[model samples]
Target: MSRRVVVTGLGGICATGANVPEFWDNSKKAVCGVSVRTLKAGDEYSITLPIAPIDGFEDRLAEFGRDMARADRFTQLAIAAADEAVRDAGVDFASGLGRRTAAIVGTGIGGQTTFDAAYLAMLKHGRKPHPLSILKIIPNAPASHMSIRYGLNGPAFAISSACASGAHAIGVAADMIRSGAADAALAGASEALLTYGAMETWKAMHIMSDELCRPFSKNRKGLIIGEGAGVLVLEDFAAAKKRGAKIYAELAGFGMNADGKDMINPAVEGAAGAMKTALSTVGAFDPAGVYINAHGTGTLLNDPTESKAIRDVFAAGADSLVVSSTKSMHGHLLGAAGAIEAIATLKAMETGVVPPTINYDEPDPACDLDYCPNEAREQRIDLALSNSFAFGGLNAVLAFRRV
Candidate 1:
């Protein structure tokens, strides 16, 4: 039989809250994180837009030995989330686990802020790049920092697939245990792309919301950029049981696929294929048993595309399924979106309360589905799926089951 993998602990830091409880409290109330916009450091924006800010991130960074100057915003978020996840998993850090434990994190754009600063320095100061420039801005910096912090000697690297990066990271790490590559793994994603250069890139694409984020609204605008990190501690079920570790939920299945079509446009068949693969792997093919955490970036293209994808996979079953975009509450955390939503799904199972999608005043007819709009619900959920679609036509789906 294939080895079973499960989530032992969860940690997340975002605009909603820095810790799990605070994050949940904000989510449960359907609070909106999108706020007034401002200019990013080293960016020259003729216009500023509202964005969700994560306050006190620097305070969290002080616990580790990483120099603030040597780290990127994405790495900072990763350290915070990974530290909490490791502690929550009841990991004996001093034990040999770090040597055996794997660290896999992801980021859509690594160190855009650092790149922005260094380039400006070249023009203004006419000086050489900073010593840590290479370290701070790479996408893999999060993985390296996490491994160094806890002495994890196992495989460590960052996966980049745009917004789908988090789900891909967690899914691949779970496969590590399934294939005997590692005993335990820390899998997640973090992103801090509020820099002027980052903003300019997205602004050029014309995807920022002028006011608020409305996921399924008929008049929905574009995505609101936000920042945060989320990490999960995964281990083999047999090993966790032997160690007397509590299993939050089984990491039942994962599905990954590429559209092979347009790099930026969503593909209906690609998204549905991943969902079907996940259901089959987890033996949760019975659609009634699953709740979906929709990608729901509040962008017009994403919301509708996701709705059709869900319908295409489950067909009639999609009608009865429970789906919500907690992104409505937390805003979009770019690459961290999937991991944090997975954590939210696990928390919903633990507490029997599915968070609501707030600011749902206007609904799009074309994007119709059971979004659990505007209110939290008490329901017994057995299996749940979190879907993430990213740039470059990458898609990932994860399955979690009540233990």
Candidate 2:
């Protein structure tokens, strides 16, 4: 059996959009979901800053059943996204597909809200943590919940690679399908780390923007934290085609590597190498038709580094390609960044309208690539790549092409 992989459905929820269609629509409109909000750990501790938060998501918890409601917010978000993906793919797991499907969800910081509450309660309130705190705080909670929820009996687990977690999970799931380890997979990531403790920790690093995320801009401040989940239903290409599935795009290539140099600094060499490796399987492609969903974190070090990497990979043709950071609109989803960005990439390819890198006030000389500026561009897209580079120099790139 040939084990080629394809993305049949995409589901996502974020500060930008509640689902894939909404996300794509908002992307085309260049809608910015980031806003100023106050997060408080207790009465004594509070911080106000710009954040991309998905408000009113709690109202939808009843639809996920009791188990998901009891799970952490990350798990809930994952289930919500997965529900949409499974429906959109029209896959009937009850018809023996569940046994051969894998649930591979990723999270950079699992159950952060639960962890924060537990510590705060124990330290300040003189109270014991909940008995289910261990289970809730486990990184694999979302994966396990998904497996049980979907009745999946194949390989089920979670990947934690900081910001690269989503891309790593999706790529690994596709690889498993290609290797005959599974026939299909629920592949994506979820993150709900906008809790007070997580925010404080991120603020301590001095890498968060107080206002907007302006990627590739000369006056770029830093990334803003966001919370949400993005899920994709991936299946074997042969099987999906045989069943007349609505194929979004073929999962053509994946490349991952660790820089091994510094935890904080991203290396241009590692990023360029991964991108090259991913393109290795893509055959010959026109740079003009390529759309790169860049890992443009809008930070002091990331924008220029990523620009140089893209230029190194594409060389003279770099100017022909269009690159954008949807993070400028949705804010950085941390672990969920790659999954949603992959969706954005696929949507751009499918619709032939590239999302804009919004909030781009000033351009930097070092980052001279065409970012599509503050407005979305309409162009034919034959290939798309979603770039994800984590804080630990973990790099993952995914390539997709129309089938």
Candidate 3:
């Protein structure tokens, strides 16, 4: 028999919240986490920009133990979130499940903070870099850490597709379970690129917002970078049911495609095709009961192009469904954007409250849709879609249904 995958647990940490419940609560309140901050390197190089960064998280780092203490910020964040997921799922790895669990974590730019510190020490301070710098800076650090941390012995690796990394990791893990490669998996993504050097590079692109991220708005500037991690515990539906686990939602469908057009510019056809392909696995659905967690980066080109894609996929029903960008509250997490957004989508389905797209002062006709606006809205949501469109024209859409 063909297997089905279900989300048995969800965990997330971001600027808006330190964990899933907190994140969802802050999101529902439309609390904006974006603020002006200054980052410096070697006292000479510094950049001031609006960023959504977590504060007071350092106090909790020691609780993760020595290995995590020595790991990069990105991997540490992943462990923080994954710990919560495993606890929530009530999974005992000691009971033979560890041998069948896969750990698939993704990151767009891994260990940016560590890399910056190492480079600063070696180049600017005329000192040797950390001996374990390579291990911490590797993109697979999170995946490897999770495997050792949780005793997972199945397929473990990292996927780096820029912003789509999270969704791609989750999708691939689900496929693995469905194909009988694994019985359970820890999947998601983490990103910690809020360093001085990283911010300077992003600033050089001139695509970052000066103030707030206002997606689908006429006065939108651009995306504000944030750092954190989100993770999910996925298990074969039958096993989850047999174990009496509290299922959050069903991993119904996943779609991924590349634009093959531009490195920066998003393609409308690519976005629409991905959504359509995801829906193909969904069979059919009521448009009014759908909620889309948009990949609304609040950028000039992405907003309208994604709007058109939604219109293309849903056609007349596009106007009926509600869509919102929680990035307006939590800021863009780059690779981990899809993972936390998927958590947001699942929360919306669970609570029937669609989080708002905050900072929307003006609406653009080109990007016309029910964005929920600055206030959360109560609606019956039977289906949810989390969209992740990355640089290099990579797009991933995940569809979930109430289980």
Tens-digit lDDT track for model 1 on 291-318? 8988888887888889999999888999
Q: Model 2, range 71-145, lDDT digits (tens) per residue? A: 889988988899999999999898999999999999998999899999999999999999999899898898898
Per-residue error (Å), model 3, residue 280: 0.8
lDDT digits (tens) for residues 11-120 of candidate 3: 89999999999999999999999999999898999888999998988999989999998999999999999999999899888799999999999999999988999999
Provide the RMSD of all predictions against the true structure, rounded to 1 decimal. Answer: 1.7, 0.9, 0.7
* Alpha-carbon shift of residue 191 in model 3 (angstroms): 0.3
Lowest lDDT sum, 10 consecutive residues, model 3, at: 276-285
Q: In model 1, which range of ten residues has the least summed lDDT?
A: 38-47
- Which window of 10 residues has the lowest lDDT sum in candidate 2? 1-10
> Candidates sorted by lDDT, descending order?
3, 2, 1
Candidate topping lDDT: 3
TM value for model 3: 0.99
TM-score of each: 0.96, 0.99, 0.99
How good is model 1 by TM-score? Answer: 0.96
Candidate 3 collision pairs: none
What's the ranking of the predictions by TM-score, best on top?
3, 2, 1
